[model samples]
Target: MGACDRNCGLLSGAIIGAVLAILGGALIPIGDFLINKTIRKEAAIENGTIAYENWVVPGSPVFRQFFFYHVQNPSEVMNGSRPNLKQIGPYTYRMRYLPKENITQHSDYTVSYFLPNIARFEPDMSVGSENDTFTCINLAVVAAPAMYKSGLVQIFINTLIKSSNSLMLQNRTVKEILWGYVDPFLKKIPFPMERTIGAFYPYNGTTDGLYRVFNGIDDISKTALISSYKNKSTLSLWDGYCDIVNGTDGASFPPFVKKNHVLQFFSSDICRSIFGVFKEERIVKDIPVYRFVVPPAAFASPLVNPDNICFCTEKVLSRNCTSAGALDISACKEGKPVYVTLPHFLFASKDITENIEGLYPDMNEHETFLDVEPTTGFTIHFAKKLQVNLLVTPSSRIETLSKIRQPYLFPVLWLNETAIIGEDKAEMFRSKVSTPIKMLHLLEAVLIIVGAVMFLGFMVSYFICRSKKLK
Candidate 1:
């Protein structure tokens, strides 16, 4: 019995040590993989800094900068507001404000004002080759000379990153605001004194109604070359970096690029137009003018006309199919609900690659397409015609609603810099951006998985030791 007990204790100890060792070994790879995978999918700056055709070249704005008027106390209406806006030069603006308190109120306001729009600070940045000139609007007091200075723009950007405690400000691009992209952690940060955002128009045309026009193009060939080139570069840059951030196998182009939607312009024409135009511009000027075309299916949407046939609405300028009575066309097959694919680009500032790799379950599956179901997780809706960019206006009409009680504009009051401006649709438009709240949920799941495995290994070892002790 004595010999048996000794042997059993020895065996049990060995088993426990082995289990513990195994757990540690397993955890190293698991944590490494999860952390690495997440980094690639979400972090854009990690792989290597990527630039577009005009990205960071000499004489261009090395960095875009904007002053952020940080309100020390946002609740007080009169206090801590920036004032005396002045213009110093083209692409440059200077604004000054005084922090004051409302009469008969002891409450105080803190005003931290800096240039809110960074892109406008660069004056020398080359204008578009064609009639397409780059312009910045609604940045600072629009007249400030600081808004137009390239050197000042770079300086402002460096200073903001250096001074601000906000993590969202790190490595942020003007496109992030205009494109409506945000990091997962940004939502957690406090408000008022935090960084607010503005639009950055990458396309040659005006920012307004641009989404509709791009969606109007049914084929890649119809798209402007600049748009196509941008899409390709964005995909390549994201894919290459996502590999490192996610710690997964590389070569995942179009990872979050959801090609199934009509937004991506899946045909080869997108690339051809983008690169082809650049080549043409090098040798000769004045590329041929191309008229926009709408595919037969452009106007089809579930809400608009469910018949699966494309119809033109009041918004479409190319052709008015509504008067033609073309809704009855049998483009949609029998027993099939007519639907058009739309592309949704997903970008996170960190660790999204791992979550996607596990979520998708296949690295080889590059193009993520989805049918519009609540379960498919597509927040935005697409019309039946792949070409027609359908604009859906909320029936409540926020602009009209804001006119009545402007103070109620922002119900959420996130980051507290006045979520809604009076009656203007711009604030409502800005509020719709994808937030980091969902990304955190994904991160929790990964941590849970890692935690469960470690716990299991620990429990198993504990049981073996207990069994030996009893014997």
Candidate 2:
């Protein structure tokens, strides 16, 4: 009876200890794997750092600078010329975000600013590109510049843009303001804005006319290159960093990153343009930042449309797309006159910038960079820099455009939207990241090993005592 009772206790002890030991053994790698997996997917799904909406109260002016290529040698500049680039005002603009409900949501919960009241603050409504250029535009022919200087032109242009019961468009959209209100002049531009939105250009960032407004960058509804937003939507230009997913292994990457990881994306080219690979990892203020550089070859790549980015084909007149350091994404806007460049011409080739006297390009101030936390896959610090350049090619027939030179892409404005996780936020995130590794994992693992050994020792003692009792 005593032997049987002792065996029963040993059996019970062994079963309990074995179960606990198995769980403890799994407390480290298994726990670590699960935690990392969960956090990475959460980030890919909803990056906490991403906010698609912002409100601007009437206050400080948004600064914008313009650089124009001067006709250093008139004969050379007639068709296409090197930029004797002149720098202009850091012109300030004031605008407010449209009301929430007033904003257009293309699909899902995507909503963006509507009719952003953009008013440029000219000291006295004076038209100034800073320097006098005889080749760019003849002020005598384009009275619009004169009118703007007098402050009456904006009011006048505003009236033409305002919604009137008598006007054809009730409340004119941004697209309408740019190209849609045409009568006879812009008839030959094939289809504009999007093919998916039918022939006519839809409303601001809208797709099928049914969905008039959509969030461009944070639109997480889709996974394709367009990031699942409305295809060919101009808003996609704002965000080129799509979600990071390893196609081969069905895993999410934290941007601590793998060497072979490449940023493969599709653009207005309507094809996949492999942007580049992660070149290096940097530590800024103890935070990790991953830097991606655009290979000069990207500008020359077949994926980029030379005809769409800029129209100069002549050897002497080329927009020098390769060296200019700007991505001609005009195709994304359906060739309706748009170009994207790094802020303040930071990445432009020195060969091209040497000709420009007043312009200064610095990587420290203008380089495009992304800061992501390796553990949480969170983009804590980020700056997506881009400048929108407008081609000011004028045909001899248009009265206002007759005087402007042929094939000049003008820098209208550039913007850098930045966000950073402050020290407090960073510390909080660190706690979250370390908790699973230190608390539950370490404790449970130690308990498993210790409990298993102690239980086995107890069982051995029980058997030894039982044998002694029988003796």
Best by TM-score: 2
Candidate 2, superposed: residue stretches over 4 Å from native:
1-28, 40-227, 231-256, 264-276, 283-289, 293-297, 300-324, 331-336, 344-356, 392-406, 422-425, 434-471
Candidate 2, residue 96: the lDDT equals 25
- lDDT string for model 1 (1-471, tens) is 574565566556555555555565565566556633543333221112221111112111123222211122222212212111111111221111111112111112111111122222234532211122222222221111122235444334434333433221122333342323343322333444222333322322222111111110122222111222221333332123221111100001112222232322322111110100001111001111111122322223323444322232222211332322112111211211111221110111112111111111121221222221111111121111111011111111221111221110000000100011122222221232122223443445555555555555555655665687789
Residue-wise lDDT of candidate 2 within 1-471, one digit each (tens)? 577787778767877777778778777677767765554444332224212211212111233322332333444433444434444333322222233234344445343332332333344422342222333322112222222333454344334323221211022222222223532211322346221221123434332211122222343222112223233233434233222211110011232344455543332222223353566777644555565544444444223534224222223224343445555444455444445666556656554344334456676666544554445434455444455554445434333343455444454335443445557645555565545445776778777987698679768867887788789
The 10-residue segment with the lowest total lDDT in model 1: 409-418
Top candidate when judged by lDDT against the true structure: 2
Native-to-model Cα distance after best TM-score fit, residue 271 in candidate 2, in Å: 12
TM-scores, one per candidate: 0.19, 0.45
Candidate 1: residue 12 Cα off by (Å): 3.6
